[model samples]
Target: MRLLWPSLAVVLLLYPALAEEHNYQLAGPAPGSIRFKWIHGSICAATNRDPRVQAVMYNEDTYILRENIAIHYDAPFTYLLMGNKGALLVDTGATEEAEYYPLRATVDAILKRWGDLRGKTDLPLTVVLTSPEYLSENQGYRQFVNRPNTTLVPLDLAKMKAFYGLTDSWPNGTGRIDLGGRIITVIPTPGAHKDGVTFYDSYNGFLLTGHLLFPGRVMISNDADYVASLTRLKEFSAQHPVKWVLGSQIDMKFLPGVEYMRLIRYKPDEHLLQLEPTALQEALATATRMLGKPEVAILADFTMRNRVGPDERPGRRPANLPRIPQLPNLR
Candidate 1:
C-alpha cells in the first residue's frame, strides 16, 4: 500500500498539468465568457475610493492589476502570471511614486496569496517590461529594481532574441520561455511602439500585447516595421489560438467614434479592456493598404498615428527626436 499512495499522489499532481495541456486545444474561455473578475465593481461603476491598484483575478493563475486613472492619467494595466516554478510580472505601469502607487507591495500581496493557495513559499518573481521606454513613460521601474527575490528581465532586442531563441523567420524568430508547465512565446515587434514586444501565454491563450496593437491611438513610429510586425502577428495568430488581446492602456470612449482626451485622468465610461483577433487583422490590413503613405490612418477600433517626419523613412527615427528619459540611479 506504501507504493500505491505515492503512485496516487503522482497521478494527482500530474493530472492538472495534463488537463491544462488538453484544454489548450480549445484556446481559452468561451466568447463573452472571459470577463475580468473585478475586486470591487465594473470599470464604470467602481468608486474612486477603491485602492489605487485594483487586483482583478483574470483567471485561476493570471491576475490583471489595473492602476487607478486618478493616480496616473495613463493608468496602464499590469499583469501577474503565476506558474508552478515561479511567477512573472509584466509591465510596472506609469507610477514613479512608489509610496503612493506601491506596485511592488501590491504585487507582493498577490504573490503571497498565490503562494498560500499553492502551498508553496517564496516563488521567485521575474519582472519584465514590454518596452524600455516604459521605464520613463510608466516610471514604475524604480519600485521593483531593488525588490527581494525579483529579477528584472531587460527588454533588449539582441538579448531577448537570444534568451527566447527567436529566429529571423516569420514565427520561428519568436522566443519561447517555459514558466514551469506554462510556455510563453515572446515575439519582438518594434514599430508602433519602441522596443515593442508581445507575450503569448500558450496555457491561457492570452496575447499580452502592449502598445503595439492596443484599441486606442497606436502611434506608428515606423510604417514598414509596424506593417511587418502586424503581418507576423497575423501569421502567428493563425498558428495559435488567441483567447484575448490585452493591452496596457485604453483610450477609446464609451461612445462610438469618440476618444478620451490626452492625459485625462478620469475615464468614467470607457471601452472594454479585451479585444478580438479581427481587430488585429483589421489593423494589419489598414497598415498594408497604407504602406507608402506617411499619413495617419484611422481604423474602426484604433487609429494609426504616424510620427515619421519628412526626412525620416520607415524603420528609422528622426535624428533630432528627444531621447526617452532615464531612470535615476537606484544603486
Candidate 2:
C-alpha cells in the first residue's frame, strides 16, 4: 500500500477540484512541497531521509504525531502528552510496515528532545489505545508493546473502570488520571465505536475524542448509547473551556463538503487538524434530535450511520466489498 511519486503528482492535481466540489476548504499544497522540510501547521510529506512519523508541536507539553500518508492511507494521528512523571501516547497509527512506521523511535527522539529542553530524564511512557482492536490490527503497536519503561494499557471497559475507580459508575463514569503535573479526565464512551473513550486534557483544554466524532462517518452501533455518550460529552464540554476537539482521523478534505477517498493513503488537501467546539455541539444537537428516529442520518460534516444485526462485531468487514487498489511502491 505504498504511493509512488508519479501517482502522488496525480493525486495532488486532481484533489483540489474534487475537494472544491464538496465544499472543503482547500489549503493549497502541503508543507515542504518544494524542499520537504518539516513545517508547523502543514502536512509534511515523508521521505527516506526523514522518519515516517512527523511530530508537530501542538503546545509546549503536547505533540501530535501523524504517519506519512504514503505509508498508510488511513494515516491516523497519534497524540503524545508529556507530564512531570511520564508521557502518554494516545494511539499507535495504522501502519504495519516496520521500516516505515517507527513509532517507538519517534517517541524516543521526541522524549530526548523534550528532556534536553526541560532538563528531565527517564520519563516513563504509557501507551493506551482508543480500542483494543488497534493492537491486533495495527502493526505500529508492535514498536512499543515490549519497550522498556513503557506501559501498554489495555482498552478493557471493566479494567479501566476499576483502575479509574469508576466501577460504581461503570460505562457512563468519568475517571481522573494524574500524569505528574498534568491531569486528564477519562470519560467512557462505548456506543459510537466499541470501547470508545474520550480523554480530556484539562491543562491544554483539548478534548481527545477517539472515533466518537471525527469529520467523516460516525458509525453508531447502538443509537441509545450514542445519544447518551454525546449528551455526556456536551455536558462535560460545557464545564470546561475546550480549546479544540481532536480526533484520530480526518476524512474531510480541506474544502467544506468534500471527503477524501476511503482508500487513498495520501491526503493533499486535508481538513484542518483541529475542529472547534461548535462542531461537536452541532453533532450533539443532530444526535439528540434523532434519538428515537431512524438509524441513519446525514449531516454536513459527518454521516450518522448505524450498524445493526449480526455484522455488529468489532473488526468485521462486510463480505464482498470491493477493495481499494493500492498504489505500487515508486521508490
What are the lDDT figures for the candidates, one per model?
Answer: 0.71, 0.68
TM-score of each: 0.77, 0.74
Give the top-scoring candidate (lDDT).
1
lDDT tens digits by residue: candidate 1, 100-171? 688888989988877766676787888776776654234677788878888877556566555556535533
lDDT of 2 at 303: 51
Q: Highest TM-score among the candidates is held by which one?
A: 1
Q: Please give the lDDT score for candidate 2.
A: 0.68
Return the clash pairs for model 1, or none: 94-138, 166-173, 167-173
Model 2 regions more than 4 Å off: 1-51, 134-139, 292-296, 308-331
